[model samples]
Target: MDDMTVRGRWIRVVATSLCGVLLLVGTLFGADDDFPFGPFRMYATGPDPNGDAKDSRVEGTDITGRTVPITEGNSGIRRAEIEGQEAAYVATPSRLSEVAAAYAEHSPGAAPLQSVRLVVRWVGIRHARPTGTYRDEVIARWTRP
Candidate 1:
């Protein structure tokens, strides 16, 4: 081939390789924070290896003052969604009230919820053995207006 043809082929190869690398790097770092191009990082990282394990669930108090555990099926929302929004809830508690409204609406014939709370019951492990210990933390709560 001519000198110009060889140079053009080499440039095309270099550009293609550069674009591939950029795409891979973007995918590795961008997750659960952006649009359709990246991965869903909701459960990408497991519980901290050094920290205690946690079992998370959402609960709410009804108008009758009885505590009710919200479920994915009943509310069309899941624990993972709750966990995902925990940070935003902590920063702005009013978001919980919006979720509570949805929870109340989803449960037919049940007394509406007065308040919603995200409670986590966690326990530490030692050497991969159960310590027979746990504690509850009320992460966030929002009451209906």
Candidate 2:
């Protein structure tokens, strides 16, 4: 083999081995409750048949007293959008009022939002079928001042 060909093959082998080591280290030591490296716990572990499925959504009451579901497209405020701002939101949930105001401005057809609330609904899933009835829990609320 030519000298250049041998050197190129060694470089490829070293690069592949280095990547494998990185992935192993990251998976072993770089995991958190909400963040995980490759080989997610969800995929590694089996789903609990009796576990409850919970969904969270931000909703609001309009001036007309109608209920409106706040969405990312409408309110431009998604929990997922706050990637690095979870702590900030936990500290001052009233910050959501700013989102409510923006949503009211964009949704002219709908009456202005009178207040906003975070609703968490959960239902038990047994063998992939919804077993228990639905339950709603309002954890947070913010009204326009």
Candidate 3:
């Protein structure tokens, strides 16, 4: 194998140093939007052992008055997408109409939605273990007008 030239060695050193600096800056100032170089805080920290675990889901009341889950298969929208913009949904519950519309477009034969809501299920925990209890909270809701 041929040896790396002095110029090539200098280029590699500069590139490595630049990468290190970028990582440092990203770690200090970047958010989740800046991945790869930035630290992903989502999994970086552990939750409090005794704190409640949250699970969010979307649900809709159909024309038949049956409440059903609005999953990715039915709505083309994932739970994570909803969780990421949860604050906006809570601020303006009317945005849930978009999810209802998405479900209608994706599942043409399904019952039409009468209302959509964002629900959060909080599971009780103790000593980092489940307590076999949970509560559902409606964070936002939109009824067809």
Candidate 4:
């Protein structure tokens, strides 16, 4: 192959330098929104060794009073989606009705959900080890009237 041109070498140097600067700035100040250039906090940090670990899930009470798990297969809504918007759901519990609606649309033949709730199970941990104990808390709920 022929030797690289002067302008091509300059372009490569400038691009590499710019990328390094962006990465430095992102590491120091960027959040998840600046991925690829910014650090992903989830991977950058470790969980508290002696703290409770949160396990979030959505559950529904059918019209027949039976508890049902609301999974992506059943509701077409992923667990991550729920966790990602957890604050919004907690702020407005009524929004859980949308999950119930999604379940209804996906499972037409199944019993209808009478209520939907976001539940979090906090498992106790000590020295990075699970203690085989957990407490469930309801963070949000929506009931059909």
Best by lDDT: 4
Candidate 4 lDDT, 1-145, residue by residue in tens: 9699999999999999999999999999999889889999999999999999999999999999999999999999999999999999999999999999999999999999999999999999999999999999999999999
Tens digits of per-residue lDDT for model 2 on 1-145? Answer: 5566878999999999988886788777755453443556756677677787877777889888999888877877766764345445456779768768879777767788888877778887988788867889776678878
Worst 10 residues of 2 by lDDT: 30-39
CA lDDT scores, all candidates in order: 0.79, 0.74, 0.95, 0.98
Name the runs in model 4 displaced over 4 angstroms.
none
**Under the 3 Å rule for N, CA and C atoms, how many clashes does model 4 have?**
0
lDDT per residue for candidate 1 within 1-145, as digits (tens), equals 5566878999999999987776677677766554344556655555555577788888889999999888887688877888878888888877888777777678889898899888888887776656779898988888888
lDDT per residue (tens digit) for residues 1-145 in model 3 = 8699999999999999999999999999987888877889987789999999999999999999999899999999988899999999999999999999999999999999999999999999999999999999999999999
lDDT of 1 at 129: 58
Model 3 misplaced regions, further than 4 Å: none
Candidate 3: worst 10 consecutive residues by lDDT?
Answer: 30-39
**Candidate 2: segments with Cα more than 4 A from true spot:** 1-4, 32-37, 82-90
Error of 2 at 47 (Å): 3.5
The true-versus-predicted C-alpha distance at residue 107 of model 4, in Å, is 0.9
